[model samples]
Each structure stands twice: as structure tokens, then as C-alpha cells.
Target: MTVTVESRPTGHPGYSQTLPREPESAAIARKLVRTALAAWYLEDLVEDAETVITELVSNAVDHARLESIRVVVTRPTEKLVRFGVVDRSRNVPYMRTDSNGDNTRGRGLLLVDALTDRWGTDRYRWGKQVWGEMKCD
Candidate 1:
């Protein structure tokens, strides 16, 4: 649970850390995000960011079928923040084609889709990265 918060010369702060594939990692990730947002003066986007982070991290921990996961939060630009969770599972995540009424297992992407300006997956030689980006005030 050692998280590093670093600031860039461009004035955008960044945070990075790795967490074990435990159920509690999601919550810990959220806390780390809140801290980063406060320092980066992006508190207005906390709620939306919180939801997005939870879904992204949980997917990596529970579904990616990996032992541990990596989390990165960075501001590629001042007005936007991008967060990604990298997992060893190469299976890219896709939203359910049909909303099975009351099915609680597959709605993570829906929240992500509604919350972020854009979200997608990228495949790497070892695994995949699930990322979401949103604009800040």
C-alpha cells in the first residue's frame, strides 16, 4: 500500500503505486485518488473519478485474474486527468451487449462509460491497460 505522489514541472501532479489483488485495494485506490485530487486542485471531479477508479481497479483485481495490479494517475494535460490500471490478464474488458435486468456482475463499464469523457483498452505484450479520462474544472 505504498503510494507515491509526485509533482511534474508542468504543474500537473501524478501518483503511482501497485496493490495486491485483494478486495480492499479498490478502496485504497480511491483514497489515494482523493488525496491526489485535493493536492492537484481537482476536488470538483472527485465523485466522478471515484466511481471510475473503483470500477477500473475492481475489474483488474476480480476479473483480470492476476495476482497484483498496477495503478497510475497522471495529468497528461492541465485540464484532463487520465487513470489506468494495468493487469496481466490480456482479456480486454467489454460492456455487456444486453443489460440483463438486475444482473449485478457486468455493469462496471456502464458506470465508466457514463462517467468518463473517453475510456478504452490497450493491449501490451504481457497484459492490457484499461484507461479512462475526464476533464477537470
Candidate 2:
């Protein structure tokens, strides 16, 4: 995946890192989210944010046939925390409800959309980013 480090105009304190696109990377992504949140003293957001991160990273590892994927964490302000997963796959992430309620899969985006205050995707020339925000206030 082509990842550019150029920061946008959000002006928030944030972090971004790339990892091999594999099942193991999901655990690493969770660890990164936990560590980053701890460093920022945003323990309140840890549980939910980690869950969201894991879902996003796992989806990338499962679907995106890329060398690597990127995870980004940022706080636009003290009241909100944002995270995104970037992958080279052009497929857009969307929430879906399965008719079979017992289905374990296909619920990743559903949980993400349900938990986050707001979530969406941003497409670039090479890929797209699935992002969500958790409100701290």
C-alpha cells in the first residue's frame, strides 16, 4: 500500500504506523491502540477503541491483498478520539445486517458503526480508509 506521511490540516496530535497485512497484525494493531491510548491517558476510550481497531485491522488483513496496512490514531480535541485503517484494496467498508442473527461474521462494520459517534470512508488514489470516532465527553 502507498502510504504518505503528509499530515492534513486537522491539527490534532496523532500517530500513524504501517504493519504487514496479516492475521497476526490484528493483535499488533490492538496492542498499538492500547499503548497509544495509555500514553495519551485516554483510558476511558481504550476498551471501545481497541475493539474498533481490531475490527478494522482484521477486515483489512482478510480482504486487502496488499503488502501492508496502516493504522492511524488521533485526537482532534480532548473530547474525541479517532482511528482509521488504510489498505490498498479499493473496496469500500459498509455496515450490513445479516438476516441470520447468529452469524458471527459480517458484523464488523455493524459493531463499528453502532459504537462510534460517527464513521465513514475516505478514498485515495491507491486505496481507502475506514475511520470512526469515539466521543470522550
Candidate 3:
């Protein structure tokens, strides 16, 4: 996958990449997030951003019905960055409240909620985007 960092004349800079909807793609998505944060000089948010993107990408890989998924990292403001995953699935993700410590899965969104300042989903005509935002100093 060829990842590109984009700069807009009127808006914040962003980075985007399309990857196969597989578990391995989570690593690539983490790299993309790291690169974007580094370019924006928001290295302090790298760990949390990577975790959020990993969960988003993992959910898409497990539930989205497509061969590929798009990972987007955008700086919406000087002190805020958004991480999103776009996939061809209309089903919105919800945190699982029924999982115990013994469960090996279903804790992704819980972690996202704990780490991110805010998180939600955007529904489009073709698909949906799951996103989370973090604030930087």
C-alpha cells in the first residue's frame, strides 16, 4: 500500500492509506498514525493514537465486508488529531459491556473510549467511518 501525507491550503494536514482488510493491516495502520503524528509534531499522542487506529482497523477487518479498508489520520485542529477507518459496512460499532477479564476479545472499544477524548461513527451512503480523536499539548 502506498501511503500519502496530504496538506491542504485551507485546512489541517492529513494522511491516508488503503490496505487489505486483514489482521496484518493493523500494523500498517499504526505506522500511518505514527507518521502523521510525527509530521504534526504530536509525538506525545503516538501511543494512544496507534492503539485507537489498531482497534478501528481490527474491527473493520473482522466485520467489514470488503477486500480493502481505508485508514485516515487528520489534524482537525492544532491540538487535536482524528484517526478514522473507513470500511464498506453499515453496522455501527458499540462497546461490549458484557466481557469479563477472562474473555480474550471484545475490549477494543472500551480501550478506545478510555484513551480517546471523543469517538464516534459517521455513516455514509456507501459505508461508515469509525473515528476517534485525541488532544495534544
**RMSD after CA superposition, every candidate:** 6.9, 8.7, 6.9
lDDT of each: 0.84, 0.83, 0.88
User: Taking the tens digit of each residue's C-alpha lDDT, what string does model 3 give over 31-73?
Assistant: 9988877776678888888889999999999999999999999
| Residue-by-residue lDDT tens digits, candidate 1, 7-122 | 52223448878899877998888988887788787788889998899999988977776689988788888777887898999898998768799878878999999999999998
The candidate maximizing TM-score is 3
Taking all chains together, the TM-score of candidate 3 against the true structure is: 0.89
| Candidate 3 global Cα RMSD | 6.9
Q: Estimate the overall C-alpha local distance difference test score of candidate 2.
A: 0.83
Ranking by lDDT: 3, 1, 2
| Ten contiguous residues with the weakest lDDT in model 3 | 5-14
Candidate 2 lowest-lDDT run of ten: 5-14
lDDT tens readout by residue for model 2, 33-102: 8877777777878888988998999889888867899999887876777889999999997677665677
In model 3, pairs of residues that clash are none
Tell how far residue 30 is off in model 2, in angstroms: 1.2
Error of 1 at 104 (Å): 1.2
